[model samples]
Target: MPLLNNENKIPCYIQNQLIHDKDIKSIVFVNSHLPADETLLVKSITLVKRITTVSVVNNFTKELNLNSVDISHIFIFLDNINDIPSASSAIANQEVFSLNNPKYYFLFIKPTDNSRDEIKNILDQVWKCHELWKYVLVFCMETEWLRIVSYNPFKQLLVEFQSDCNNTTMFSNMLKNVNGYRIKTIFFYTLKSSKMENGKCRGNDCEVMETFFNYINATNEEVVLNVTEDLLYPVSQDYIKQDRADVMFNNMFLYIELYKYSAFAFAHSNVYAVVPRASTLTFLTNIIFMFTPIVWIGIGIIPLIYYHLLSIFDNYAIGKHHVRGILISKYVYALIFTCIFQSMIITTLTSPKYRKNIETLHDLFESNLSIYGVKDWMYMFHREVAIRYKPWNNTSITSALNNLTLDGAYIVGEYWLNLFLKNKTRIGGTYNDYYYKIKEAVGTGLLTYYTRRNSPYREIIYKITLLRNMAGLDKEFGYREINFTKALKSKSLTLIHLQSSFVFLSVGWILSTLVFSIEVITNIILQHIKTK
Candidate 1:
């Protein structure tokens, strides 16, 4: 009751004196109007409050060499205590003074703007001193909005201004986009180490490359197959030697290229690439037709006719009128007639409209002794007879043909019939050498065909060969020998041989009669000239 007297000056002066005392550890200012200097003094006293505690009083006195006559906890309050420069000075002093007692903790009350810079400076000091930052905590108060923000160097603080914010949906969307996005492309990188290895697969463990064809077919994704490099060679390998080892690799590469091309075409259009089998009789027959001397003979005849015509004209221009002119005219007529007859024979033999009778290779194999003028007759014999003799699944083209030849069929073809010979050598020991003999047996015009019409797969086989040749891939197998005997035995040729032989003979006889008449007329003209 006595303290309620109107004279309040006594308690305020006493509190100010207590705050100024050097023994005070804690300062709490409770006046409604705190003077700026007094508020600064309160903050300074609070910064060193722990030093005044009883347990460390003697230690603090000893370290600082200060007299500890009295100790007390003091408190202070100021409307804008943080606005005073003494607050920052006190914080800096506390940071340096507390260095000796590393375990000591301090609490700072700061305005929001000063809080960030203060915490940053403290963290910089801790980092420079190599001190543990885990214990440092800063509290900042926004008095205007009544909001409190707390910061720690070692911890992340998330303060949402909104009370009922939903972060889960935002976080989920961010994660979904970040984790589930991918770019579309198939990349094949050729490494250096493998490229330098001789006889190595350039694929570099990439035999099974990914293709968009399957993906698009299955998933309907608008995918495209793009090949960056059409050909990749081993870095330091000799191309010629590596070719053999690279055969399979090359095959795979070609397969991919072809697949891509085919897929592209199929996607846009309806076309597809076709692969050919070597064992089909139609394939052999096509080889025979392509290699036939008749075709070559037909090709050679044009130049021969031109040469003959040029010779005749040259003789006429040189004024060798009596001797050279008459002789050249007769020769020209005979040659022309012969060419027409031969052309008719070839045309009738090769005509596709008149289908051949013999359908199978067996028919040719069993035929009576017949002459063959083909270059690589071994392949024909093998296809017809020897392949059937010791046939095995997965047999190579050369092996099947060799087996056919070993079964007593004669093969006549070019000496360098390398394709048939090389394959035969690969499969047959004794008969491999027989290719040399077969090659030596090639003859001119013994018998030949315009085409092999009897084989059912003729069209497909020809298409395959043509495509391969067009792509320059046919050299891989080398040239095949032509077997005219088997070719003529084809059903198409058999029908032609039976039905058109008479017409050919008749034409030939008529050409011979004409030749004789020309000779007779030349003789009569010579006699008349001699009489003149």
Candidate 2:
């Protein structure tokens, strides 16, 4: 409803019209200060009675000033075929055309009193501007001769098609006879798969493909794209990097970047473990002394030998009635107690704290847990967290979270991670606790089809995208609500049960081995004294 101009002021009288009128639109009339009689054609059109004027100065070198005006539609009047090129050039020089809004052009021309040769000249000029100013409507001053211009709906289109080789040449073959600007393709090439084979284009074989063979030649088909630079296909970059042609060809109008709630998910509202350097070293040292193959074998053998000695003591005490048998039994019981005490100490040191919870970046930075994430996500994570972590590769992030050596959470985009959550069993966590949304969002990205700079089809694509969004067609293309607070109700039983069991088993093994060593040393001393 608001109009922008060089002087950032809105007229008071128009304010009511803007408020009262349910529909609001902006139309601009571009001209060279023509006479009142010549402007009669534009005035006759009731739809654009309140058009804002952007008059071109007499000095042809200087461009027209359209500063601060938000123009949605432009009306250009061509008095004659001779004025076509100059008028088109002046319209091109305006800054309003470069905005992120839709633009429409209406061409109003005066009837020429010239021969057929002059009419052909007029058509030539119109065709020249057709490629530049798309979505154009041509009007004649004399209504009787207006039928002379045969209007084909497809005449103003410039299509840059994208499709997989599987679609073959069907799309192009369908639009062969459609009158319009030339259509180009945006193809991608990788080392393993390309649009070309053995220095020849694959699309050159089919009838429709043959028509565009030269345009999409082998050299042209092979292109390196930087999709991540725009964050357009953040979740689907892996697919686009390899086979985006198929994705674009199937989806028509309004290519949307999915807003996924899971992208911001990090572990929160749960207790996180922080493994210190000292505890890791101490734990590893205990494991080494306890799990040695020889020591482990002795633990099993020594337990059997102790049972045999108890039987011998029972027989010796009954036969000889000796008090020495009771003394030996007491000594073995003390050794078992010593082993049990050592195992308990190891378990206590390794037990992680589960009381403190992390909810913000400040808490995460202050905590001792090391952050680990995928290699490709390093740039995005580095922008948020201070700690540097070695990038993980070809591994599931949830599976890696089980490692007590790392922080329990990681950063992943919505596409890959969300798919992973939907299909895989919750091995390391429950559905409710899969991911926690961070307090601050790094940023959001828009997904757009990659095309050549100054592509003629850009305007047409923009219009299609806008129309689709208005009609709610983007929902069909995998759009979903991003509820950050929502979580799954069920929890995984295996993950919770195994986390503590692994630690207990490790501590028990070390304790039994220490007891076995004492039994071997005691036996050696008894033999030495008997030999003496």
Q: What TM-score would every model get versus the actual structure?
A: 0.17, 0.34
lDDT of each: 0.30, 0.37
For model 2, how does the per-residue alpha-carbon lDDT over 488-531 read when each residue is reduced to its tens digit?
22111222323343344334333433444444566678779999
Clashing pairs in 2: 254-465, 266-436
The residue-by-residue lDDT of candidate 1 on 1-532, one tens digit each, is: 1211223322333344344444444222222233444444334434543445322221111233323323232122223424223332232233223222222222223334445566455444442233222122222233312222222322223222211111111111111121222212222233321132365334322221112112212111112324223223221112212211111111111122122111111000011101111233553354345324654564456456546654544543333333344355445645654554455545444332222222224333343223232222223233333343332222233343445443222332232233234443444454444422321222221111011111111222233334434663334232434343433332322323323433443454455445555665776788799999
lDDT of 2 at 131: 28
Off by over 4 Å in 1: 1-197, 203-329, 338-392, 396-398, 401-532
Top model by lDDT, which number? 2
Which ranges of candidate 2 are over 4 A from the true structure?
1-24, 35-72, 77-95, 98-130, 133-182, 189-441, 450-532
Cα displacement (angstroms), candidate 1, residue 215, comes to: 18
